[model samples]
Target: MNLTPESKVLIQGFCEFISGTHVAQMQAYGTNLVAGVNPGCGGQELHGLPVFDLVEEVIEQFGVIDTTIICVDPYDVLDAALEAIASHISQIIIITAGVPPLDMVQLLRKAEACETLVIGPNSPGIIVPGKILLGTQPSEFYTPGVVGIVSRSSTLTYEVAYELTKAGLGQSISVSIGSDAIVGSSFLQWLQILDEDETTEAIVLVGQPGGGSEEAAARYIAEAIDKPVIAYIAGRQAPPGKSWRQTGTLATVIGRDPNFGTAQSKLAALKEAEVPVAERPSQIPELLRKEIKIN
Candidate 1:
């Protein structure tokens, strides 16, 4: 949600091997990580931060935590997230990969009912370049600036940010909405946030071939977003099954579903919406610059 330098953060299922460096890096980057949640490890210290047995304990001791970064075992992600939501943490970022889709479905229902914002089951989370890091986004690629970047591909998110930074276009915020098939957030959700954000001047949407998300984003941008927007859809040349890693998208490989989740359709939708589409990550800066100038 409204992440800032002062946002108090906690980690769910905190593990030294999985989350140690990230914790240290977040602290170094100025993120206000107040505590962590790892059952049976309560009262223990890792990375010089307090670890709690439960999300409620962390809340009771630290007061309101703004975000919780979940890095538990794949199967444990659901319980970890439910605990965070129950604790009333506004933002939940799930970093564990390979979470069963059913678990995500359940988490989404609870999150929506509680008005909670979940980032990913397989995500890099959100970063406010030079301000705070909520997940494991590499800090080397980002800088403080006006553009807001949102992507389904974590690797592409980094490459795009590096390109933007290289072109002297730093980012106001960068969000990896998770590469999983059933993520908590969507392109339209973050698009609306960026459009209304005072610090964000433009938006870069990095999409993949699978799913109708890119097409949905195009429709939303056409009607709702006032700020300039540019897009780069990966997997244009990727064969059906190889296009995306998500299970649902992988089905396209066998079904050859031409009407859905095709890169051609995504590009057509974005083009029809008048959104500039970059052929490559390096071209994003140039297209974004053109969009900003025109708007």
Candidate 2:
């Protein structure tokens, strides 16, 4: 779970207000802002960071970028993603803004062909505590520790990490894999990394009502992982035909066989498989304490 320092991150859509805020937040977290791309804001300064009109110009000046954070509108997301893949400047690319699923499907196809690790077209980005902060989350809420957290909801990820810190349990890694249906990566992918991380003693998975991803992970945990897992599946009893906050939740509800009963059934599957499922958010800390002996 150690985050090695890399050269710089090339950020997309520097002209937006939220993008500017995200840059400042990352700077506070100690990440060097190397370059930015905005088609209209070329040659201007954004919060003291140089802005370029295009990705090519930014890459030409900055050399290789370790990461790229996309903060543009959904309409522009696919083009930005293609540019990121073509540039080959970063090992990781994070898309913080929400994009259409149809666009994401095309983006994912390109990403797989390019072999690039894309995180979120609708996410909070990844935080490798004490090393780099590449998303919209507050830096003060994170610390370097031995627990790895992976969640679908950005807000819930923040709350879970906050609670862990309050209980004196810091985190080694915290990832919000976005709430979008066709977004990059999955809970299992992050869980694989955490399972092998020597610094991680336990895992905290925050899932919402939707998808069998949690159930799949629970089966993995039951068979493969030895470390304790503490889970909280949100919106279990959410009424049918209503969408929850997470986009993935809504998609899972809409596209499944029974059409909308997947969430509660997924929770039941996890519990049946012996995964410690918290019925409520408040029960998470206490359950985790008992399972991991963190007291």
Candidate 3:
């Protein structure tokens, strides 16, 4: 499925740390880097691209940008995002910096008010196959295909998509839904999109040991969707009271139970609703093959 035509993206707070990595990967995928924004590095060149002093400067130079990838420091995340919104340079914002929880909440509030489609406070950005690579995912892991992928971890998203592609499956859209607790977008949001896209025949959801997002998506599948969903939840045996490595990995502990119940519960719910929950990562391809053959 094709994304909206407006794919040109501004890389916000581009600096020595992430500029090279992001540019090389995204350029290989055919995305244009409209401009780079960094306060003090305006006149300098990075990887042969001009760096601007601010988001406003970038907008003035490059016109309005449809997307912005925020790769600034955690302390500067909110300020950087506000700058992007003020310039009206981005409708879709992907914040790759991992901000503190309190800071993330503030950012989310501002994001909602601006009506911008924010991807993460701690995400690896997004990839649309031959279109754009907004973050650091290896460009070789993706190709044009029919399965839509949404995941909480960037690494896992890359792994699943790479494995799927190697197994002869391509993705319609692969989104790494940043691990921040209060980040923007949800699996259900993407689910609706994939459900409507004729190219997307199946969906692969990668959930981590955390919040109710997976469970929420499971409920949505149970109630509204008929397409086959294959799910794999990480950190299945995480200890209670300690946050999982990623944001949103919070499960309530009860007595002797270690909250492994959460993932299992969601898996059980999906299975009950007739959505196929993969018992292991290796099973995903075979399951998809079987479903496609049967259908």
Best by lDDT: 1
Encode model 3's per-residue lDDT on 1-295: one tens digit a residue.
2244356677777543375766876776677777777788998887657888887887777786788878778778788888888876445455554576787677678777877677886777777776667778777888888888888887888889888888888887788878876777888887887788787788889887666788788889888767778888876675644566666543354663554436666666677767777766667888888777522
Runs of candidate 2 with Cα error greater than 4 angstroms are 15-19, 90-97, 248-261, 293-295
TM-score sort, best first: 1, 2, 3
Report the CA-based lDDT of candidate 2 relative to the real structure: 0.76
TM values, all candidates: 0.94, 0.89, 0.88
Q: How many backbone clashes does candidate 3 have?
A: 2
For all candidates in order, the CA lDDT equals: 0.86, 0.76, 0.74
Task: Indicate the residue-level lDDT of 109 in model 2.
Answer: 83
Model 2 TM-score (2 dp): 0.89
lDDT per residue for candidate 2 within 117-194, as digits (tens), equals 777767788887898887787778888887889998888898888888877788888888887766788788788888
Put the candidates in lDDT order, highest first.
1, 2, 3
lDDT at 295, model 1:
24
**Which candidate has the top score in TM-score?**
1
How big is the positional error of residue 271 in model 1, measured in Å on the Cα after superposition?
A: 1.3
What TM-score does candidate 3 get on C-alpha atoms? Answer: 0.88
Error of 3 at 246 (Å): 1.5
Off by over 4 Å in 1: 15-17, 246-257
